[model samples]
Target chain A: MVSATPTRERVLAILDTVKDPEIPVISVVELGVVRDVECGPDGVTVVITPTYSGCPAMKAMEDDIIAALDAEGIGGARVRTVFAPAWTTDWIPDGAREKLRAWGIAPPGAAHDDPPVQLRRAGRVRCPFCGAGDTTLRSEFGSTACKATHYCNSCAQPFEEFKAI
Target chain B: MSNRFFEYLLRLGDDRLVLGHRLSEWCGHGPILEEDIAMANIALDLIGQANLLLLKAASVENAGRDADALAYLRDAREYRNALIAELPRGDFAFTIARQFLFSAWALRQWEALASCRDADLAGIAARAVKESRYHVRHSAEWLVRLGDGTEESHARAQDALDELWRYTGELFLTDAIERELAHEGLAADPSAFRSAWQKDVDDVVARATLRLPAVEHWQQGGRTGLHTEHLGRMLAEMQVLPRTYPGARW
Candidate 1:
């Protein structure tokens, strides 16, 4: 009977084990993709927000959530995606930034406190591998929709920087 | 009535879908490796936005159609994307010019939509405004570089701008449906964006050392489901898979 109705905390713990498909080092929880987890008489509904609208990984993440709950014997689970608050790099936990940097993908720079007009100018991005500030934007778009390509002059490495948006 | 709102959503979604498809064509064919990745990334964003918008449209229609069904099953005549989106990806200059013009206008459209009365649409717009901001900056920078670069690049950029100017009018056309939505604060009046878009485009063109051509005749009709021949061919390629194999999933 306990297995049939898992607590929200238990569901969350199971979700913490679900890693982002693209960046395997961080769990979706750490990435802040899991927006909400509501336990109701009907079922458990997990609300997720996509990092980017077109991110191919969203479908995979949704499936993983359902699978993880099912594996834990927590049936009647549903995954819902919401875009109201919208996902931002700011949602990434403090520790996850270091994890992403150590994994070689430069985490996003500081959030856009400045107006949008100033965003046209490239922000200072430190090299994830070398910790150097001398980097130039190679392209606004990168290997993934959530990233931008940058060339680190200090280490002579072309790296992907998770875009601040 | 929800009919106008449904139509409005389709207009927004179809534009992004068709434009995304066009940009996706540059996946491995970009002039530079960086450009290849950049174009693909933008394509992903546009397509993603299209998915969300179409899903909202489907819900509004309440016709039991999903985003995939609307995106993959729609015929060419049924599509409401602007003619500018369907124009062939000519050269790098042409593609960049088209993107610049579209992004400039889209940035403002999304900004207005962000504050509209519809919460769901506002949410989508709020998120898209950020993406569109980046897109405009990227394309604007490229416009400057290509226009002010080599002699050949300058001429190509000029020529592309001239050819594409005629289609820009369609973007700002406000039909009865849009006017009604705008009056109700449900949708933005595209005509109101003209001055801002012009200023934005003019600033970029001046910095790029390119001239805005004197467009004599303006082409319009994509909003009403009338499209150029180009859309038919593009749809043939885009819709082939779903049309051939019904209910095929990845």
Candidate 2:
């Protein structure tokens, strides 16, 4: 945007300003939603992947990305969604995890790459607020598809964990 | 696109659409607060998958109609979902029973479709395969909990499984449409996953102390557009918004 040619770094910086509409603290880049930013002769194309298959925030995120690019005089940007390497919590970097924990959301545990259809819901999530390890899963799904609701037995406070997808 | 392919996409798309709508009905009515949220989340995933798939089908058809048009415009008789999906959302047990049954099959089916010859189809399936794993686990865990819980819960879960067992056969049917696509490597062989699905279901059923009903006449006609009376009513509710407003968007 600074050079009118729209360098990848500039596009990423702008995208960093575009926080995920659902989880406002974390930028899409930090969430690993913005897979790539391609600046071609045609124009800028922001490639993104959905955190969940039916995440409603995706449209809002797409619109926000285009709007963010357009604000810097970069118009006619295209937002494309790809699903080859499916979006995972593994994409969320550690610094953003700190931001999420500070915001009272437990960051996701490591994602499993093994076969599907396991019975037991594995892993324990400590409370982001009290850092209590004695947390019980209140629900497998939380307010968003990417998260699950949990209750901390130690502090008696409710928290959400970014589900390990 | 060939008529066969269009029809095939409808079958895939409609299953999610109808079932998603049914699950959405549980939004405010779930037995527990967590379940209400879970049902709505699952519904969102299904409808989201349906949106992507039906959009692809519309593109292939080269018709002016888009995914919304296909989903909102189509009537009950025109719907191609399996009968098992269109069955009325009965009790909480019934809902979990159907979820366990179908998600088990969908897990296997989507797994096969994950490597489909068509890139668009494969991409959709690959992402959905991940979602289906959670669906299978969530529903399967509930099936066990409810089936093994107490006298009342066990009875209800068993009764629900018995009533819904007949419709499970329809999913495994490999008719000409599926055969043609499977032959071309564009679709999974529907019958190929039946045994694995059975084992998966049986394992959970056994753990839950629930009994599968003795095999009766397998109900199979949903593929050919023959559905139960339930589909028409469900479609009437689903299509009402689009039909009434036409191009209305919020």
Candidate 3:
């Protein structure tokens, strides 16, 4: 009797064990870099797209994916990068958004449901420190390429907000 | 015709290479830490674009030189970048203004370039247009905030506009190479690009509550490689390490 689950599906199931080092809220799959999974008689090939070219996170993510799947008894896994139709913030899963809010960080103002025309709207981000909606932008650039610094008026604390590129 | 194609690519690549070098100098000196990282990120993107385009230029020219040779070994007079890209990174406001202006124009240029007759140019343009779109957005966002934020910021931004305005005209000046390329469907008409660029700048400026400088005598000659005194200083800094150790690599 054949097992009901396909090999590719089993590989993805194993990948869910790997968590993002910084956020630790979601696995690599929620990040949307895992574009496709293919399994053959020889081995399994994983196709991942980078959020940004030369992103440092990509190397670590690749290693984590490989290590986790190898522990699951699938030894021949190959990772490849694709650049066409580049990855966007919209690809981030809904589960990650909930995790971010629970972690005391404001979910990014840019949501996937919004059209491109709505991109010009001013982002009304709540302060991560005091959970206040009256935070003001201190600077557009942040500690990382993905975050920005903002000061909360309520608690008088400064915190980082993830900037939607 | 192929020479012209290579020439066009070199001009574009050199603009990015020089500006990237200027922007990198601010890696640690930005007004804030976030901005410091932001400028560094933008600098890296620009340098990456330069390498891609320069490599394409070398392949098209079939010259023995690769991207590195074309970038480092070339003399000041050999460079064909416009004056706007070569100007000093004067102040934070100045840097933002330069980026806003260049990125807007470049976004349009890359949009048109994506459909070039050459397969390589089209592919490169397609990849680059997305990056330039983000660059324009980032720079334009800063332009709006600084221009409308406070009296001091408004004045400083306007001053940057005034100082940099003279260099904008040369960006739309068509040359013999451009003319030849356009006829072959390999380039965009510079004149056709001006009005669109104007509309873009005007919309941002209006939103920022700022005004443009009155049309003034426009400077020219960067296309011909005749540069201001600043180029000498910039080249001295950028090429010094490479020139000192001819083939050394880290």
TM-score for each predicted model, relative to the true structure: 0.96, 0.97, 0.75
Candidate 3 on B1-250: residue-level lDDT in tens?
8888898998888888888888898998989876788888777678877877898899898969888889888888888888998899999999999998988888778778878887766756665665666577778888888899899999999999998888999889998899889889998776877788898899898888888998669987888889888887899888888899998797
Give me the displacement of residue B131 in model 1, in angstroms. 1.1
TM-score of chain A of each: 0.91, 0.94, 0.82
Lowest summed lDDT over 10 consecutive residues: which window, candidate 3 chain B?
B125-134
Off by over 4 Å in 3: A1-29, A34-50, A53-82, A99-121, A126-132, A153-157, B1-3, B55-66, B114-156, B179-186, B206-211, B214-216, B246-250
For residues B1-250, what per-residue lDDT tens digits would candidate 2 score against the true structure? 2677888888999999999999999999999899999999999999999998898889888879899999988877788999999899999999999999999999899989989888888888988987898899899999999999999999999999989999998888888878999999888897788888998988999999999999769887888878888888888888888888889987
Candidate fnat values, all: 0.63, 0.65, 0.13
Fnat of candidate 2, please?
0.65
B209-246: candidate 1 lDDT, tens digit per residue: 99988888999889888899899999889989998999
Candidate with top TM-score is 2
Candidate 1, residue A100: how far the Cα is off, in Å: 0.7
Of 1 and 2, the candidate ranking higher by lDDT: 2
Q: How accurate is candidate 2 locally (lDDT)?
A: 0.89
Query: Which number leads on lDDT?
Result: 2
Task: Write the candidate numbers in order of decreasing TM-score.
Answer: 2, 1, 3
lDDT (CA) per prediction = 0.89, 0.89, 0.78
